[model samples]
Target: MRESILKRVAVSRNVLTMLVALWLMLTMNLPFWRSVWQGVGGMSNDSPLFLLSLPLFVWIWLYVLLSLLAWGRLTKPVLGGLVLVSAGASYFMNCYGIVIDYNMLTNMLQTDVAEATELLNGRLLLWLLLLGVLPALLISRMPTRPLTWRRELAGKLGSMAVLLGVFAVLVMSQYQPYASLIRNHREVRLMLVPSNVVGAVHGYLKRELAAPAVLEVVGADAHRISAVSTQHRPRVTLLVVGETARAANFSLNGYARPTNPELAKRDVINYPQASSCGTATAVSVPCMFQDLGRADYKDSMAGNREGMLDVLQRAGVDVLWRDNNSGCKGACDRVPNEDVSHLNLAQFCADGECHDEALLHNLQAYLDGLTRDTVVVLHMKGSHGPAYYKRYPAAFERFTPVCKEVQLDRCDTASIVNAYDNSLLYTDHVLAATIDLLRSNAARLDTAMLYMSDHGESLGEHGMYLHGVPYAMAPSEQTHVPMVLWFSDGMQRSSGISADCLRQQAGQPVSQDNLFHSVIGLMGVRTSVYQPQLDIFRGCMPATVAQQVERSELRVD
Candidate 1:
């Protein structure tokens, strides 16, 4: 009796799929339509014909595309996934002001469970329940005509031909304006729902499914060289990988706020103009550790072979990675790495997550025991948002009326910035503490700390809330990162790096591109891959010291 009733209410397969697509297009894509409305010169009598026809033309194309895919038994599952993914993309886009693109999608995929959990707030749940789960369930429950593959294929092809003709007519109606909008605002393409998701997945798969690349080792012939090499004293350096820390927020970089009160007092060399290789951790972390700048970097490249860490390790440097953020993004695959969050230290950790200061646990002991040219990579959970309030402890919450809520959209811009700044305060504390630790051990070892953020964050800037917009359209807030260098007296004298010269070069443009070669130059690692010109410290080092940093080919053997 139930089957009979379901059959009576059942629609043809194409009808059900097209209806679901229409429902998703109408409801699940508010952000995409808003971008479209703004793009078409919203609410003005400006080119009334083209403005009106453009959105409809886009609609027709989306409908045609979705409908064509909804032909058979696969329709319900595919449409359901589209509905859920579109809802997810919509929630992020509409609430956080992020666009779904290949990089953003890759970022999402790479996010750890702890990181993903923070994003699961009431509003996101509501979005998923109202728009994603309910609709996906409805799509699944809706009865469709039984599949007759051969006949269905024939009917779909015939219907597709007619749809294409109508689509062609719509396109020709406003060809110039449509072409202009598309060409001028290419970012609009990334704002579209489901299509944007589809295109991102396609782009990801295209790279992922390609022929397997044989691992190519980088900096294989690396060997250390220093004018003042010590058999007893070791070069102890801290490579601090900051998370989502923008240069504009750091007072050391001349932000209006005194967020870096501790760092300011420390007399660190602050590079105000240092930008990131990418706007997200997934891309930036690995790219910064490689010779490849943003232009040539790919996520796959990180996994293809050894990176800077391996090179440093190969050159008899005691390399260690301590993580409070997500794992080292494959940069520490071959290094002795441990996660602070896993230790769950009582004061510094909570709920399987740790404060940035947790990374410093037992660090003095580690340095106390270090006997070789040592490098420790501290991956910090610095200022990663919308859960900015959670990054620091109560003492670090110097900013009042801060947004305690994880869902950032609920808070005012001031609250968001306040919470964000507090996290930076804590980061400042962490860096200062690390520097202090390094300074304490300076007598035993040539100690220095080099802190560079993987990427920057957007805090309600130009309607963008978080980072990971497609790089081409990302603003300075998402790309401009903070880089700080603090070397103890021993390191400064031993390495021949003048603080005055470093301060002068700090104002000049520096980037993560310099990181790969800069570390090489700093440790006096001689390698074919080391380019002295790419090292920021090269100018600060004496010509005699800098001359030794040149690529082996450029050197007189």
Candidate 2:
């Protein structure tokens, strides 16, 4: 009886460990498997052998890494934690089509509870239970094999070395094919299960904690130029930093739908060719307000440096940031900022979320208290999704049969687009209403509104649901953002910038790089850090008598 019991216990321990290992290998990599399966058709055209062998190699690589990291007695607990994280990562990647990288993980850490709750749903809970909780429970309950520390360490090292040798041999044998595959499909590397997660977390921590304490400040000598008040009207310019609005959907940008009907009716210059500095708000918002262009802009640099708002404030320009989404991602930390997202506005707010129009509440009263050279930034919650239907008021539900659920995959492609477009329609209404608010104060204030989204969103295009894919691999849907400029007649006269000249330059290729200088130019803030070459409006403004004549001819009567 004793012998039989000992054998049964040994069998049970082996079986449990095997099960745990298998679970980790499969559950942590569902997204990767899905990607490979989907790309099978395309794989035949490229390197079929490499594609076929890639999965096995990845599985072995992951198994070896996990085994080496979590061996003997400590295996169960460590593996449990990894199981949860990997499962969660896989679920997000599979559902939202997001790549989990250092920047993305950093963004995840910074996400407020309110924002994180928006992504929670039955589908997510189900995935967590099946993949994370189930595996974790099994891992915790499993009895690990007892071995001497020396033996366990030796086994782990030997196993790791063997795995490394195998991997190296495989790479060497299929060097050309594997190299080509990886080079062409760089995104494939991002889907490497728990390895990607491990690397990303480590990278995030190192950057977050080990960076230099002091940062270089740009535009320290920023002062408003005398050209700011030629007509003596307070140069009040409202920069509406929109969220997740793409140029492809804007009516003014020649979309089939009249999404921008209200803005289109106004004398707004729609720059269809405008691009974003970064693919995510966390990166784009700060980069847009920085003197550094996209090529030079780094998250670490942006975090430590004085931004456009800082420079503007230093230059004696009254800078106020009114936020409706995620607290301006720390861009408005130094300046006077307001969080109107929680206001109990009966018209546009519900269920802890307010529409973009909520931003305009008490605006006239707020503007009344501003300085003569004021720049009020309305950071809008425009078109933020996967709950696109929730972004707009019920009246603005022009696109019917919208995707009401957060689980985007549950909805059809058409429904998703409909919901997104409805949000854009509401955004249009809010922007027009903003213009009207500026128009109300047009007599006293030289109002001009610059509306540009921080980053574009992906709506079920190429099996991708939301934005925040790496910038290099990101599609135009995630990069080509809509930028519209509406200048009041007072603004045109005071700034001596012809409306026609600005309109003629609307089609030019511009980006978030132009924002810092263009605003400085518009407000007439004379900053040494301001780059004229980066400003979109610099070349467009009238320079000579001949140019002024051409500008007048191109001006709308």
Candidate 3:
């Protein structure tokens, strides 16, 4: 009997081990496995200098383990219970005000679907199948181990203590490596985990998590512009926001494609070297348009009395926001805003759904066919998202061999770029069309169209696919964006902007912040609060006294 028992015990151990191995193998064949592997490697690479930070990693893992152990006691099935809880929490956060876009999901997955598929097609699947089958078979043959209530109780108490300890440390930790931990917290509100923990982790590797260099500014009275501009009437300016537009990808900026064919011919002043404030719309949009600089964005939002929109409105300009984005944040609160997302405006085109055109369709109607000296803001859903092909119509699909879908990594780099370029091509057409619309009323209107992208995107460079990394650590492909301004003929003549001179300064480095002053100046509005030193129009002053505006850097987290 003793000999038989020994053999049975040995068999049981072997069988359980085999079962675990098999499950692991099966998981490896799935996309989720690839995501885990890739994410671990990517996170590790981001902080290679701190690769040996064992103590830190151990602390985190231990904390998680302890929490799981405690939960196990309270719940019969603790491990599964914890995972379910986490998933529910994530869903709740997304369902609420916190936006969980594709970037967040993709980043978490690590390995893209393409890589996972490729691995499945190779030897990975075979090994996983063997492991998955062997483990279950062995586990089935083994006898169940009886559970001791006393021992389970002890484990639960011990785990709880450990979990609490870790929580204390996290709260005490200042200058944490990842701001994502904090940023994400805003959305998820996990008891301890921050929404931006991902970004915070990357911050340990790169110092780009701060604000952009351009907005490193402090308090300024709104009435400061009277000294610079003579005109006293309140000047109205409209800021046209472009989404996912890359400078190098636009034809106006010399992209090989004819993306901006119309804008290029219209003599719009394109700023070639303009960099974005952040990599994603969530980070960049708020930061760029916010009153505070990147470094102190949170503080600025809390402490500063007003944002760009607020400041302009305070100066008596009619600030109107027309958006085609999924939703508008508080950025448009001070002004009247219209949500154009629900409008069905694609009458001429059938292939592409209503996007940027949605915001434009009712513009004339919104204006009541009567021109108002109003500052109208048009936020375009231009080139937005994983499905590039879906953003544009077939007519604008001029660039062939394009990646119509978001599984960009599966396609060759050139083809993926071609698809993106085609989207840009569509963007160019919309912009050109907008210009023409404005020009048609130029005789009675002092209209100006200023186009600036929230951030740039990475096609497949450096083994990365999309945007949303901290800007400083991000590739130049993600930072450099295109900015072009279409000044109505009347405004141009009023500002005394020579056609030859304006063209000469086309390639200059002008930060988005400069628009704050230039717009007010061009409108001949004499606010006492505007800064002349940071204005680009100052650069265009008489060449004798013309001074180059200082290039400011933005901190991105």
lDDT of 1 at 480: 93
Model 2 lDDT tens row, 1-557: 96566555543332344455567666666666766555454545466666666755775677676775675666777778888888889888888888888878877876667778989988889989999998799678654456678876776677567767878888987888667657767787788778888888888888778656886676877765545533377889899999999989998888898898888788788898999998888889989998888998877765677788888887778888998998776578789999889899888788997778888999899888765788889998888878888888888898878998888988999899999999999899988998999988877888899999999999988888888888999999999999988989888777767889888878789999999998986777666787878876667565762253333321110
Which has the higher lDDT value, candidate number 1 or candidate number 2?
A: 1
Q: Against the true structure, candidate 3 has what lDDT? A: 0.54
Candidate 2: residue 137 Cα off by (Å): 1.2
Q: Give the TM-score of candidate 1.
A: 0.95
Model 1 per-residue lDDT tens digits across residues 299-407: 7886776789888887767799998887888898888999887785789888778899988999888878876788899999999888999999999888888997776
Query: In model 1, which runs have C-alpha deviations exceeding 4 angstroms?
Result: 1-9, 211-213, 226-232, 547-557
Which window of ten consecutive residues has the lowest lDDT sum in model 3? 548-557
- Best candidate according to lDDT: 1
Regions more than 4 Å wrong, model 3: 1-78, 81-237, 299-305, 346-353, 365-372, 496-502, 524-529, 541-557
Superposition error at 96 for model 2 (Å) = 2.1
- What's the C-alpha lDDT at position 25 in model 3? 29
Cα-based TM-score, every candidate: 0.95, 0.92, 0.65
Mark the 10 consecutive residues where model 2 has the least summed lDDT: 548-557
